[model samples]
Target: MRVLGIDPGLTRCGVGVVEGVPGRPGRMIGYYVVRSEPGEDIALRLLNLDRSLAELIAEHKPDAVAVERVFAQHNVRTVMGTAQASGVAVLAGARAGLPVETYTPSEVKAAVTGSGTADKAQVTSMVTRLLQLDAPPKPADAADALALAICHIWRGGTRAKIQAAALAAARRSPR
Candidate 1:
């Protein structure tokens, strides 16, 4: 499966594409940081982000999209900008008719590094090793985005199978 992972932020949204199945190392298709000027109006920033994400979705043609779920932060402004960027990312995936899943930071960290509380350095190191990259992806956000893709590739397939089986069983049961 090919997955596009997004770590959304107003000024520096991370985007990455990975392709592989469960229980194996994923290949990095591409990685990028979509940047929007912080000084720009919020509407303009969001619009630009949406356009960039749309182009990425078109170019990569991912089977699914995995986004970092927005969580509470002390700075409301920061959180709000992240949440807006995240919405644009999700919408881009949905517009492309792909399944979109959101994972918390802890979930992504645990999947990549086997520790939910793993720090950025740990996650970056693990991602570099897992993907067999020559060097770690830059700007922490980029690595985080790749980690999100790896997490979904590893877990999403199993989740889909489980859901399919449950649906089949329900269909066969007497009401």
Candidate 2:
């Protein structure tokens, strides 16, 4: 399965792609950060995000897209901006006919670091190690995006195995 993970922000949205079979660790396909200025008109910024996201999806042809769910509390405006960015990502994936799934920040951190409250540095460090990369993904946002993809692979594989086992058992059962 090929998966893309996204970390969305108005100023900088991150994208990463990983591909592998179920029950196997995925290799990174492509990862990068999309940058836009906060001062730029929101409409224009969103357009750039949308276009870049589409290009990535078309280029990678990911089977699924994973993204971080918003959980902002103190900054309503920030949350809204991030949410909009998330929507743009979903739209891009949908446009390419790929399924889109979201994992909460805590879920991603816990999967990647064994702790929901792990800090950015910790998450990034572990992501680097998990992928066997020599360095952390660029611009922090890229690392965050890759973390979401890793979390989905970890969780999705569990579900996929259960379904596969069920199918195998049914096949073996008497007609």
Candidate 1's TM-score? 0.89
Per-residue alpha-carbon lDDT of candidate 1 for residues 5-124, written as tens digits (9 for 90 to 100): 999999999998999998899899989999988889999999889999999999999988899999886368699889988988987886676777889999999999999999999999
Quantify how close model 1 is to the true structure by its C-alpha RMSD in Å: 5.2
- Candidate number of the best TM-score: 1
lDDT of 2 by residue, 26-59 (tens): 6887798898998899999999999999888888
TM, every model: 0.89, 0.85
What residue runs in model 2 are displaced by over 4 Å at the alpha carbon? 21-23, 157-175
Cα miss at 35, model 2 (Å)? 1.0
Best by lDDT: 1
